[model samples]
Target: KNKYALQLDLVKDLEEAEARLAEVEQKLDPVGDYVEASMIAAASAQFHNVVAQLRILNPNVEFVEDGLDEDKE
Candidate 1:
């Protein structure tokens, strides 16, 4: 009974914390956020291209990222 009560209290606390985080995230700096997102996107594309080129250069080698095959399984 005490354990169940503690679990319920913890869940309620987590719900409150998540609500606060959502409220704070809603107040982000718009221009900074957009610029940061764009930079991340550019970097991701460049990384993807490099990985593709590496695959082409070593066709027989099955890399961990060959088909983004690391964490899928």
Candidate 2:
């Protein structure tokens, strides 16, 4: 009987711990999403900035699709 009671108490504690972990994860999900979004936004801005710098450095360069043909090379 004592063993069964101890086991029940342990099970209850485990359940409470799991519930708390779940709540904490739920709270952190939005923060994770915001960080991910921020990284993506920063990367996009950097890419555009690089493109702009490249254009300034080579204003006369024409952008052609598929680039130079291998046969022409």
Candidate 3:
């Protein structure tokens, strides 16, 4: 089995997924009265989920945005 190729594919997939999640968060940005509290919470949850996945992919990777609780408050 070509383990290197498999690893490369996995890395590519993770990068793409991260990009898509970021785009979702960007789209969810509050805009006037069209935004709701529930939507903000959902976006926050998705962002945390992505951070968790990234950690799983690379245990040594450190994310500054993962400390989002302080920012949210």
Candidate 4:
């Protein structure tokens, strides 16, 4: 029981760490359309990779899509 509790605590810590990292990343580089578009794109790609890894680690998770317009499609 103690071991299970410790494991849950560790998982919570990891989740918090990931959220903090993401927040820092966003603060450091505010998203916009400018010369830094390439940098933003790279950062976004890296962020997606990290998120994918997290999804794999946590099986009971679903990723949501953004900007889905039926007319555009």
Candidate 5:
């Protein structure tokens, strides 16, 4: 029973962390045009790193790819 409670607590912590991350992303979204692109690129790189770590930690989980082009040969 204690292990189950710990697991639930960990899941809650993960959810809160994700929410805080989204809040940070929202705050960063409204910068002026001159810096927005660079900021977004940096943020994307950081997000990718986090995702890679998550994948390593949860090897059984699969991630879906987006924006694949069919025309490219």
Candidate 6:
């Protein structure tokens, strides 16, 4: 298997899921909203699920945001 390919594919999923999660998290009032809070919770769960999947694919591989995270590599 191509490790780069695996990483590339899942990183995209992680990014998308994280984007959705962050969007809802930033826009919603977690303490005052119920339905919107559920949406945030769902998105958050999805983001973590993708991270779990990536780790399962390769426990030693590191996950990073392509354009958003600090680079030392």
lDDT winner among the candidates?
A: 3
Report the lDDT of model 3 for residue 57.
Answer: 97
What lDDT score belongs to each candidate, Candidate 1 first?
0.78, 0.75, 0.78, 0.75, 0.75, 0.76
Against the hidden reference, what TM-scores do the models get? 0.48, 0.45, 0.41, 0.41, 0.41, 0.41
- CA RMSD of each candidate after superposition: 9.0, 13.8, 14.2, 13.8, 13.1, 17.9
Greater-TM-score candidate between 4 and 5: 5
The list of candidate 1 runs beyond 4 A from truth reads 29-73
**Which portions of model 4 miss their true places by more than 4 Å?**
32-73
RMSD of 5: 13.1
Worst 10 residues of 4 by lDDT: 64-73
Q: In TM-score terms, which candidate is top?
A: 1
After the best TM-score superposition of candidate 4, give how far the Cα of residue 22 lies from its true spot, in angstroms.
Answer: 0.7
Candidate 3 error regions (>4 Å): 1-35, 66-73
10-39: candidate 3 lDDT, tens digit per residue: 999999999998787778773633447676
Clashing pairs in 2: none
Cα lDDT of model 2 overall? Answer: 0.75
lDDT of 6 by residue, 1-73 (tens): 6999999999999999999997887677556577665777787777778877988998999887455422225
lDDT for each residue of candidate 5 in 1-73, tens digit (9 for 90 to 100): 6999999999999999999987887677655564665767787777778878989998999976453312234
Model 4, span 35-58: residue lDDT tens? 377766677787778878988998
Per-residue lDDT of candidate 2, residues 1-73 (tens digit): 6999999999999999999987887798845787677777787677667767888898998654353222231
